[model samples]
Target chain A: MTPKISQFLSQKNPSTPCLVVDIDEVELRYRAMQAALPAARIYYAVKANPARPLLDRLVFLGSCFDAASWEEVDLCLSAGARPENISFGNTVKKVSAIKAAYDAGVRLFVFDCVEELEKLARFAPGSRVYCRLLVNNHGAEWPLSRKFGTTPESARTLMLRARELGLDPYGISFHVGSQQLSADAYEVAIAQAGSLLADLAADGLRLRMVNLGGGFPIQYRDDVPGIAHFGQVISRAMKIHFGETLPEILVEPGRFIVGSAGVVSTEVVLVSQRGRDEGPRWVYLDIGRFGGLAETEGEAIRYMIRTARDGEEVSSVALAGPTCDGADILYEKSCYTLPVTLEAGDRVEILATGAYVSTYCSTRFNGFAPLAEHYI
Target chain B: MTPKISQFLSQKNPSTPCLVVDIDEVELRYRAMQAALPAARIYYAVKANPARPLLDRLVFLGSCFDAASWEEVDLCLSAGARPENISFGNTVKKVSAIKAAYDAGVRLFVFDCVEELEKLARFAPGSRVYCRLLVNNHGAEWPLSRKFGTTPESARTLMLRARELGLDPYGISFHVGSQQLSADAYEVAIAQAGSLLADLAADGLRLRMVNLGGGFPIQYRDDVPGIAHFGQVISRAMKIHFGETLPEILVEPGRFIVGSAGVVSTEVVLVSQRGRDEGPRWVYLDIGRFGGLAETEGEAIRYMIRTARDGEEVSSVALAGPTCDGADILYEKSCYTLPVTLEAGDRVEILATGAYVSTYCSTRFNGFAPLAEHYI
Candidate 1:
């Protein structure tokens, strides 16, 4: 725990668990992504902690929206995002939810099967649809093929059926899984989507868009590629597939939007012996699995936990939550040393996990406190 | 997916990620526990769901309250529980929370260290303190030796300090851990608490209560011991040590009380082939890791998932969550099969997990719907 962190919380507000978003960082990243892909469409996946202020800012920056549920759709609409720009992309949606989206004028719906397509057609025929195709493993770092995606053998058949039903099948989309490390997988998925569209050309269907789904690695971990390098690969794949005239590129990047700009600020509750042995003591922090820090498998997302004010250092201590459960630990082990006198009530901030944090947290385990989101 | 399940959901409500409490089953279990442990005092741990209706029933049944936070304290007080009957038993508590409990006339608080005790004294001076002792390995199936609790030497020192500070320390408590399969762990923990209290007596501190904390197991899994069988071992230990008279036996039962009675009803959206060359097929359910079905170290909590209306024949199928992530599988290989002929839009109820289900769920992964809770 950092001494400056305690002083900072005392100075502002003494809330236990709160998400602090660096607005400048988010703006910079969004601007960078916009600059790189000028013609490509960017849909901000709002499932990643849909703070209203963040949403309002994203809309102000002229970004389109990709909503998963009617609630997210409502949130975007309330924030003044155009309904036509909002694409409802979850695989399994309730009938009422489908009707609600259609009634709200959301035209682009992602479909993986004939069942979903039929359901959409019955509820909202003439709506624009995107047929999601499942790309086979072309040596990707994790076989995320288990998730929702129509396989190659069935994609052509599904597209033909959509055409027969008089629904405007606007595009094809496939993600190489989130946190994808290799450019090869993206290239293969794009090639696969292009080949499927080409195969369906005998039906006289003109593919207006091809979405090589966003798994462009952000290099949070050691082995993932940088965004700029991955951009070059995407550009190359688009040129190779479309023969000098590419369709519009649509990418949904949830983590890449605000994941690195957010930190869960917490306070130290206790520092005690981890065991009876003469080993390192564990420093219990206010945040736990309850605070969305549990996303990492038994390890906390790396954040610079130190004095929030003067940046005074503190000794390395094992971070533990207040929950009685043993698995409620935040960090596997302490990595950094501190300089200040840290004790009970000292504050610590967990970093780089803004996406899919707090708003997607389980606030009911052993009474862990929720973080107050402060946009920087 | 069971055939009967699909029929029910298509006919009835088909919502994704909803929790339902079997009130009849809960009442039966509550009565059975009350009958078995007539001599002991029972306190329902509010950390588990804390349903208002359930708490009301427990209050009417006359169980003392166990509160872990100010929110729980507020809930109990609002539910008309006398502050005297409620024990604020969390080891690490905020100063404001302690002060709030003190203002509410809460008298007893549990402390795990000298620092916590000191914090309690500063806020709620002259209140009786219960020092939590570290239970040595008593062979509990899942020993909770870590997190809270001090060593014997440190506990003794803390007790001596409490006396010096002109404060009264009344008791010792030790939780063996949750879901204990072996009864021997309770004996060992009680013996351990007794030995420490005996040593404290030698130091001239009069200890009134010895809370051999609750870890009585429930049969979520087959191998876990039955409540009655585990109760025998606990009662026998109390008789052997205290000899027909003992400090109030406060057993904190959350999962044992409401776990079996609670069920989550989810809609089966898609039935997909798991792997080629015959791996198996999966019925993707609406709930995921964020829903109370989060697996502990990749093993989901054991539950009997079945259809509500029909006694249809069952078949094996893996239940996957709606999240795009591969880790969101509820159960990779379900032990028991549900009724057959389950297809898209079927409802499956996962039983015996009411305790932690709704309190720890998120509906926004991959833009999924929010978790809705209903208590009957």
Candidate 2:
């Protein structure tokens, strides 16, 4: 947790099962990315944590936004972001949502297949449209399926179609995947994009931008390669692949910007070992899978946890949320260890939960309220 | 879809991505379970789509409730249910919640460990508490972990401890699992609980109840053992184990009571095959895993889907939700087939989605609102 969040939790002691986001930390991460990639325009992914405070900070920093929906476009606009500064980033979108975003003056949008391209052509007429290309998800913790993106061969045809349909064939975009572990993942995608760009140029289609979609990783339970390593790797890859005649660089970083800026503070509701003589103790917290820690699905994203008794005796434990549903478990096979003396009412803080958490909570599953939020 | 729900949808033409629940059908299922298990008490598990209208209708039919949280307890009471008719069924609960339930005159609760039993003894003093036993989740689509129950040996000790600590050692409880398919699953669990009850009696503690916690099946994409089949198997098992001196029989049916009573009405957002010549079509809907079809995680609860063009030629398709997140996919490998003519603006109905769909929705995962609810 950031010092700002630590001080807020210590002083305010907001109710358990709430998130505390350090807004200053968000601005700091934004500047760090800006400084690292000086030429690249950083589009803060609004879907990560679309809180007004976070958006307001980014808006003040003149940060561009990558909105996933019409609602998110409105959120960015409400925070004083310019319409031209936001890109409708989700590949699969409703025609109605496309119309809404267009009517709201948003021009840039992303599409993968011909159907979505057709929707944008008809509803978001004459808009800047980019085709998303499918690439390898080699080292992502939350790897995306073929649910999105088209083949580079298909993307070439689709971008050509976008131009034919009275749309600006703006650029190309592709996601390496969320929480991407390898910088080489982006390298591979960039190479694919470069080859496609070179082929498109021969067909008299010169795209102006290369939208490097968000997949930036942050510190969790394990030590991840810092952002500097990713910046250096991306810069070198761009130089190697697209040399002198460089296109506009656009990077969407969601987790890297806001992930470490927040923490989830929960109370231990119950702890059990199920009467076993030899097994990990089951630790139950007020917040769980349905409660907001959804990235823990399949034990994919492990978050570092802290307690008031952290320096005390410890034992191996399985962690779960407080719900009646069996699927509400957060981490089981991950082998998380906690203080043996941990009991009901003890405060516990899950670190680096700032992004993709507050909004993922169920409205009121099992009659429990959604996780409350505090932006310091 | 039920005739009532189908009629409601055709007449109402509500907004897309909404759940239409037939309250009359809910009453019918409640009464059907009551008729099948005449000697058993039907406690409607409130976690499964606890819309106020659903709860109000069940209350009017004189149905008792199995609440997963203190807020659910209040929901039951607000719906005209008597305090005595509500049982705090979730084993993992907060001490403050226990005190609140006790102060509200709730007398029955469930616990699986010593720490929880002590909390009950202190906060809910003299309340009737049952020990939840861990049973094999064989033949269950959504199998539970060792998260909410104790072994029979541990249960016996906890029950004795309950008696010694000014609390009523009410009985033993075990959940076979959600969407349980095999009739023999209940038989094995009943046998386990029967032996435990016998052991507790040998300690001079006369337990007064046996909660065969709800696992009654409802039809989905695949056929399951009907509620009648589950009721008969449970009745026969209880008879073979306890004979004539049967304790109070309690069954908490959440999904079975409401699963088939609701249908999710959604609109097709986009369809893509990723420019592949031969592959399953990728059909994206207005709702998905985070949009309330969370049971689709691991593709467990497969709900039968119907489209307006159902009679048209069909093609194998992968279903997904309209979100920016990659994990928002509903069914990719489950081999769902849809009308080849299905396109954007086409209405689709996800059947047997009444139980766990509405409340499982993320509040606003990617700027998309939670699944709207329409109870008739």
Candidate 3:
């Protein structure tokens, strides 16, 4: 446990619960992804735990930033990301956020629905925009295909409206749902996106970019494809669908970029027996659903967890938080043996929580503050 | 809508999201429970959203404070609860916390494990200690039995140990579970607690109090029993099982006291249609699982949502939040007919979130700040 956690702890003060970033691992992945897709631009989703150190590293790797809110826009700006390189893709933007992002130099934004497009038309004149297509290509059944993305018909209308308003509609973007495990989903989404772009071009609309919205699968489970392979498949599909003339490609790889770069270190507060005979015992930890790990609810995502001291392996024990609520249990059920009994004051290291975890969760229950983040 | 929200919002800053508390609702429940258990004392669990206004209201209702941590103890003390009226009952006491609570003038505490008792004995001598009994009297299905409550056999040993250390072992307590829906569970737990108290008394240990523990169910779901009837059941069990000759009885009610009195108000950001032909449509709100309402997960609890404004009623639509993650959907599949089209900038009130909502949670994700709180 200690060996696994040594890199995460402050050599001076190791006991404090916090989020540690594996900068080396992050840089290695960044370099690999960059090497694989040298022509494609990578927009680091700033919503995935925007610590300054991580932002700095992404900048060093030539990765742009994807911001959701004005605050995120300001964060990327502070991290020295050029506004021209940042994409404000929250879709549902407040007028103030729109102005702020534009003023902060963000050139590209996403237009999902007509209302959002109208808002953009009224507030952001002459801004480069990406009309999001609902790639209902029967991709991953995930994300339920029902939020921001407008239908291809609606996307056509939005693109025409953008042209009518003299807005620079530079490209089309579509998310095939997050944590999408199917490789065919990308192939189908890319085909749909390619068709939409061709239709818009046929309708006299020119495009210079196509944002294949990021849903590149991260290995939360071994059954999922590896990130490198996912990149290769997507690149190949883009070439196959649109050929060599495909617009300058952009991938908003949020989870794949930072998901494996961070680990949350929490203490085991209590361990209790569950089923006396046939059931597995449970060990209550200091983290739960609110511990920046909302992706597990149905994302088909799982995290690597281990003891934080002495390099011990923990056995299969259900984990729950201190919340009296039953749903506070973290894992469904799994088994592993630890080097030692996780007594009071023992810490557990949860891996791959860097991405959608803390960035999308809150400490709105049990009074546990969000873990302080540190980049290695 | 503005008119309805006016009662729970700041007149100067009306648009900010917030949790609103109705003091009267909390007070009425506290009084109803108090009147039913004439012989039983009341310790309001402050960990269940210890809002200052709520604590002040509970104090006005003549309820003692039950603090689970040093932060809660400090909150109670600062709220003007007399030191003698505060009981520090967290079983796993940090050494510093034990010394701190004792120094803060809290004389009553619950000791569950012998190790904790010994630590408290070494640090806080002559304190009025309560032995927490591991009464697995909850329904057979509730498998989290080994967490708290020292068993009767071990509790007796702990009581003797405390007495040997010159600590006043004045009471016995048992926690059934949180939001316990079963009236029989409380009755059985009380009966078992009575037997334990009687046995301790027979062993020449005088009992000054008996805590029936907090499992007082709140009406989160349609099938949950109302607090008024549940209070009567618990009051009757204590009176019948302990014969009214019991020590100054105590019951800690966390969820029941404030669950109905509070609601989280957030604005609608977007609405999206999910699935096709036969799928559900979702209205995206600004709140989610990490947004102080734990109702989004598998927790049996449900939030009764309504439009903040009174006007035309619209069709029921599924609700989600601003997070890009799939788990950000608020309603699993529940439909809510609102007073208006929940467009951007419209507020929706998520009711029954007062208990174990904000205090147990913090706004740490996505760099979102916790909603400001208000008291009505």
**Top-lDDT candidate index:** 2
Clash count, candidate 1: 19
Local error of candidate 1 at residue B281 (angstroms): 2.9
DockQ of each: 0.39, 0.85, 0.29
Provide the DockQ value for model 2: 0.85
Better of 1 and 2 by lDDT: 2
> Could you give the CAPRI-style class of model 2?
high
State how far residue A286 of model 2 sits from its true place (Å): 0.4
Query: Which scores higher on DockQ, 1 or 2?
Result: 2
What tens-digit string does per-residue lDDT give for candidate 3 at A1-376? 2233364464545543567777767777677777777778888877766888888888877788888777788888888888888898777676777888777777788977666777787778788999877765354524736555777777777888888887898888888887677777777878888888888889998788888777766665355777667778888998987888868988887777777777778777655442133444556666666556655554345677766454655455666565444445566543434444667567677777777666544553443456567767
The sequence of per-residue lDDT tens digits that candidate 2 reaches over residues A1-376 is 8788888999999998999999999999999898878879999998889999999999999999999999999999999999999999999888878889999899999999999999999999999999888889879998874678889899999989899999999899989999999999999999999999999999999998998888889989998897888889988888888998788999999999999999999999988777999989989999999999999998999999999998998999999999998988888898889999998899999999999999999999999999999999
Worst 10 residues of 2 chain A by lDDT: A142-151
Ranking by lDDT: 2, 1, 3
* TM-score of structure candidate 2: 0.99
Model 2 interface Cα RMSD in Å: 1.0
Regions of model 2 farther than 4 Å from truth: none
lDDT of 1 by residue, A1-376 (tens): 2233334445777476787676566777788777766658898878765777888888888888878777788889999899988988776677777899899989888888777788888887898888888776444433456666777657777777887887887889887876677778888888888887787776687778887666554434344566777778788888898777788889887777787777677777776653256644577777676656655544523445545433565555666777666667766463645444677777666656677776666656666545567775
